[model samples]
Target: MRFDDIDARMRVFETNHDHCVLPGLYIVARIDGRSFTRLTRERHPFEAPYDPRFRDLMLETVQHLMNCGFQAIYAYTQSDEISILFHPNESSFSRKERKFISILAGEASARFSLSLGDVAAFDARISLLPSQNLVIDYFRWRMEDASRNCLNGHCYWSLREEGISAGDATQQLKGMSNPQKHDLIFARGKNFNDLPSWQKRGSGVYWQEVSVSGVNPMTGQEKNTARRSLVTDIELPLGEPYEDLLASILLDGVANRSPILEDVK
Candidate 1:
């Protein structure tokens, strides 16, 4: 076969199933570490349940994505997973799902691997939410998941400290209710409520606009320019309060002339 003919035939397989997200819908790309158990255990032995050191690495990855010339509005990270919210009008790479997934996963993998000083991999999936309410609920869903994980982690670690094997600790938490787990953790004299909010709610990253005073060297006059930057939110609210905050950010992201979710370049 001719070189051009062979090239065209092979390219079809790559693009045959390519799908693009619809316009006017919120785009959330979730990236999760692959085989993190073996990875962490074999090379990076991080603290069980939660670790700020690991959290900061993920935060660096999230910040890179937000500033990577995408119209990302918000980013949330918990455990070894990250969720990035993009504005409805995002048209990068023609909204191709595979492009977003591959690049994001690659970006996260690179960022994490660099921080950990070892190879790490992340896979990504995109979620398209049609309505504002659904978008709000989507974040709340992740937040609630973090809460449940926090409770279970505390219970399991408490048992492990008591000399229970990892398998036994897992089984114990599996049969316990939320209240039971809370009680079990409290019995260790470690109040789950006293834990850091980031441990329970995960961490959030969003763009903030600030005003900076600048003096024009040529004009000799002071001028104020609006600056955009990323802010890490650890003490995020839960339940309805979180919904309200997300709603405000969502509205602002899609609003006309809004500063959030703009191209960094």
Candidate 2:
């Protein structure tokens, strides 16, 4: 009946469900906006398929996550979702799965809400990739998903513009082949291939070292400095090239990075 005894009894249930990601594996945390279909279409009404304003909001969330002491090597965002790849050796939060899921979801939701000037919620789940091949395949999959979504979106909106109801548009594209979708949109004067790469392949964010030279007023001397900053890739490659690109990043990301130095003249 004592307080300590009751606490011990409850603690058993709490620790029983604890799960941690195994070390020496790459961690990918994908956060998706919850009920964002309704939020975007019904409430906010953003441009279908893609929106610059919405993309910027998602990028801001990805930037915040990369800098949140998570040691994320790369981040990708598209269509109300963001996926971040963390370095293999990062041991944050003791590699607790729940910690990664809850914290990332909370951080993404908060950052996106701030940028949107309204409430936005996200749910996150971690995937432990065992090898570089899997990591490359994972991103390749997302990029392909982006392409599929982009095609479907443009087609649906095109039909809607022609006064086709949402349900009918969905039904129209339901059995359409890839080439058929392209032809359908092309007939309507839109080229799927000419659309922005970001729309088709999603956007990527990675760190790059920039060299800057500045003169000191007091010393009258020049100094070279290096700093690491996030670079957004709006025009990402597709197909095998995209996979090879991600494979290279996953293979030599930190090894090839230059040391950031700041020595004032």
Q: lDDT per residue, candidate 1, 1-265, as tens digits?
A: 8999999999999899999888887899999999998876567788887778888888888888887777888889888889999988989999999999999999889988898888899999999999999988888899889988888878887888889999988887787778788888888897888999999999888877766689999999999987666778989998888998898877777773235443331
lDDT of 1 at 92: 91
Inter-residue clash pairs, candidate 2: none
Candidate 2 lDDT over residue span 125-150, tens digit each: 88899988889888888888988999
TM-score of 2: 0.91
Provide backbone clash counts, one per model.
0, 0
Model 1 vs truth, CA RMSD = 2.6
Clash pairs, model 1 backbone: none
Instruction: List the candidate 1 regions with Cα displacement exceeding 4 Å.
Output: 1-4, 219-223, 256-265
